[model samples]
Target: MTATPPLSAQVAVVTGAARGVGAALARNLARRGAKVALVGLEPEELKAVAAQCGPDATAWEADVTDVEALTGLAERIKAHYGRIDTVVANAGIALGGPLLDSDHRAFSRVIEVNLLGSVATARAFLPALAESRGYLLQIASLAALTPAPLMSAYCASKSGVEAFAHAIRAEVAHQGVKVGVGYLSWTDTDMVRGADEDAVLKQMRSRLPWPANKTYPLEPAVDRLAAGIARRSAHVYAQAWLRGMQPVRWVLPSLIAAVGSRDVARLAPRLAATAASRLRPVGAGGAADTAARSDRSDRD
Candidate 1:
């Protein structure tokens, strides 16, 4: 295996680059002098982020949930850049509903974008990463580490992302391609804003104590991501507490189960009352996307 290279002369491709943490990460990498490929569902937004990244950036919009779109993206990048040094699967959607009444389309969109999209990004770019001895960053959420009531869909999707990254990392350890999984805490992103505020999350907001004495901005996580790419870290947690939380799975599993049992009993009525879809799709005719995409995911 070879050492990870410096940002200069390196081309970093990031999904969900149009806004939020994805855009922030792109700006940080570009400032460090890395060439960047900004891929997202929104091109105009991507263009804005690209401009901020300077002349070394390119923006392309493609729904990551579409497998064909990703394949085309891979071909385009391989043709233009010849090699992509680092790839960050940063795109994800937020969805919340009771496990019973989850919208079929909305639910699938979350899983497709959060889980399948990450895997597709890796499959599409792994060759270049291995050849360049670069890095792959999979952005998982704090939800992946712990589940909350009314967030069964979001939790399941991100949990899959976290696990997939780990499995891939193990498979490719000797290929000179480093993979890192990022576990982040509650971010003030659009996803969070879009989710239905069920009683559990609301209670957490109002009552559930934050173990960390501080709540930091997304900028630090962006810096940590850049550093993770440079260092080829196996795992990166935005907040420090995640390091302790992962291993505590043994202890936490039981503790969280106990807490969840209490919360679920109290929150069940609110969860049951959420009969119809709580989401309003932000774009197009608003027909449907995630949950409507698949029935199996809808049930999840």
Candidate 2:
């Protein structure tokens, strides 16, 4: 018998594939012989990423927060691919600033896109995934493991998704469909680079202890994620150290509270000065999300 190729029969869908981790992960999956569906808000960037993923890959422009669009897109993907093996709910945005000084719209937008968006993606694709007995990987962040002072919205959204994925994992197991939560630290992605552009945000992150303070390269991180997808791991850690964080997660909030307050106090003046400008989401992906929302509002 001819040997089967790796992931040769797999069909994977990744949201937020326009740039950063999502783009890189899509390419990784494609390289492993999986047909990839790239979904995101940025059409041009998504097209470029799809081209890079070879002929078997295609791009779809849709907001993760839009249920109707995602539902339709999911059906279209199933029709095109004949079977869906994996779905990566990786769409997310972040804004950094004290809650009192933050843009209320931006803060709420983060929660909607990061938390509710993942839920919508699951709802849209779970049927297809169940039919194939495939996997769904929900991309969460270290923010879910440990909260920081200025990242209230991000932390809350990530934490919610982590819980959401865990709850559904049990619910879907009987159907032979697997659910996994992916945890990434500060990888050198657009979002992290964008956060570094602000002085106060940069300094605050720099003060994080040991390995957590470091920014890791993207390729190695995506490699781990791809490996996790192959195994359908319950918890995928982009950084090895992140796996070690699970046991200590319960104590992290209290530790951050005790230590972070001092840092926040020292940075208060600078934060106050830059709060207005920093109220919006960070990075190119974030910019695209903001513009997409604005365009939709105008159309409405």
Candidate 3:
């Protein structure tokens, strides 16, 4: 690792920075004096965020699923900025449904972007991060901690992210590179907005507090993400109450087997009716889901 500095003019790279919490985090980091790289799939979207972040920000449009594309983006950022002090692997997608009827392509996409994409971002930036004794934040979810029924692919992707972050942290800790994992509850982001319209999901979001709401907006998570980058933390739970689930996550396996059996029996009809008529991902990413609900057969 390179010599550590007390944090000024540091370069921070944020994946998925084009929108939602990722975009918010990029703005927050820029405010805190870090030169930021805004990475996303859409240049126009990235430009919107970059415009707000001011001159210290650069935009990189690359699909996280494409290794060569993300690698090239990382190289370009490194070449321009000379170092990457913080890398936030924040790009993600939610693919949820019963494993039996889930869209296979969507499941694959989620794994590629969330699980593989997080790893690729870290791999591409690790050299510079190690050079700066920097930090890497893998933005995971509570799904990683506790797999809710009907979210098999999304759950698997995030669970993979958590384990990946933990192992990478262990590998790089001695070298002064700090790795972190972020767990957030359903925010008012596109992903959750998409999920919220569902009756079961609506019920789930209605169950959170401490932040006092399941949908606590993106600001708190964005603020904490910047703080974690500055302090070089190992993990940041956006909804602090997520910690309480740790004890239960251990029991999650048997709990699901026992509870899922009963809950699905009750939840099935509600999940089906709402999911059939109105289940759709919302916001800027709505293009993909516009025709997605027409037929499950069409997605495959």
Candidate 4:
């Protein structure tokens, strides 16, 4: 492992810093004495987080899906902070429902924000990160490694981000810009609560295999994320068990499929009647069919 430089002297950028994991991460970095640029879509909420982060942190409202806006935001942060030492592409959204009952657009929007947004974040910040030989961390999820019934879009997006992060790591390592991917299980975040609001979804999750059904506290995960940034780790797992799943991931999908097959068969009849539209994630956008979905409860 490379020795960490003084965080007090580094400037870090965290996307989706309005709430949940992103907000927590921004605060954690600030507590460690790093200057933070809080990036996200919620202005008032972002400002509130920035306040908690102190004078060294500032919030900018920019959607991660817009490349130009993100690029401009990066330049502005660079101009203000003088240099960038870390970039956490932590913005993501989620949609919940059986794919058969899900609106095609809701699923597409999740991919746009979670996967493509991470890609945009990486591209926008790469120039500054490369200049400083800094670290780029992508906030993926356990969804990336494990598949679940009501999270097809979410799983796909996270899985894409994981693969993209690895590919980017290889492309940029020579430039001294380290890339890291963070994997988290179900944490105490608004997204999980939003999904749980649907009784069917909640019950479905409860039936998952041991450890997989566990919901961890958020702060510990944030602490691990902060440490990962400091260490410039290749991969970050918020919970210990998450690390073990990495190696057995190949077997996991099959195991989960075997267990869920019965549930799927049982739920198939009820899924069509589950009012999936009402089950849309809290604070999601779009028309009745497709609104901006916030699976993570944080905007990017």
Off by over 4 Å in 2: 1-6, 283-289, 293-300
lDDT of 2: 0.84
Root-mean-square deviation of every model: 4.4, 4.4, 4.8, 2.7
* TM-score per candidate: 0.86, 0.94, 0.86, 0.93
The Cα local distance difference test for each model comes to 0.70, 0.84, 0.70, 0.81
Best by TM-score: 2
lDDT of model 3 at residue 112?
70
Give one digit per residue, the lDDT tens place, for model 2 in 1-300: 222225768999998888888889999999998999999877888899999999999999898888999999999999998988899998887778899998788888888888898999999999998888889999988888889789898889889999999999999988889899999888887667756768888899899999888999989999999999988889999999999999998999899999999999999999999877776765444353445431111000
- Candidate number of the best lDDT: 2
Q: Candidate 3 — which residues are off by over 4 angstroms?
A: 1-7, 204-213, 270-300
Candidate number that wins on TM-score, 3 or 4: 4
The true-structure Cα RMSD of candidate 3 reads: 4.8
Clashing pairs in 3: 209-212
Error of 1 at 16 (Å): 1.0
Estimate candidate 1's alpha-carbon lDDT, on a 0 to 1 scale.
Answer: 0.70
Better of 2 and 3 by TM-score: 2
- Candidate scoring better on lDDT of 2 and 4: 2
**Model 2 reaches what TM-score against the true structure?**
0.94
Off by over 4 Å in 1: 194-200, 212-215, 272-300
lDDT of 4 by residue, 1-300 (tens): 345587787999998788788888999999999999988877888899999999889989898888998899999999998999999988777767777676676678778888898888998999999889899998888888888876788888889999999998999988889999998888887666666766777788889878878788989989998998888899998987889988899997888788887897887766677754544434422213234422244211
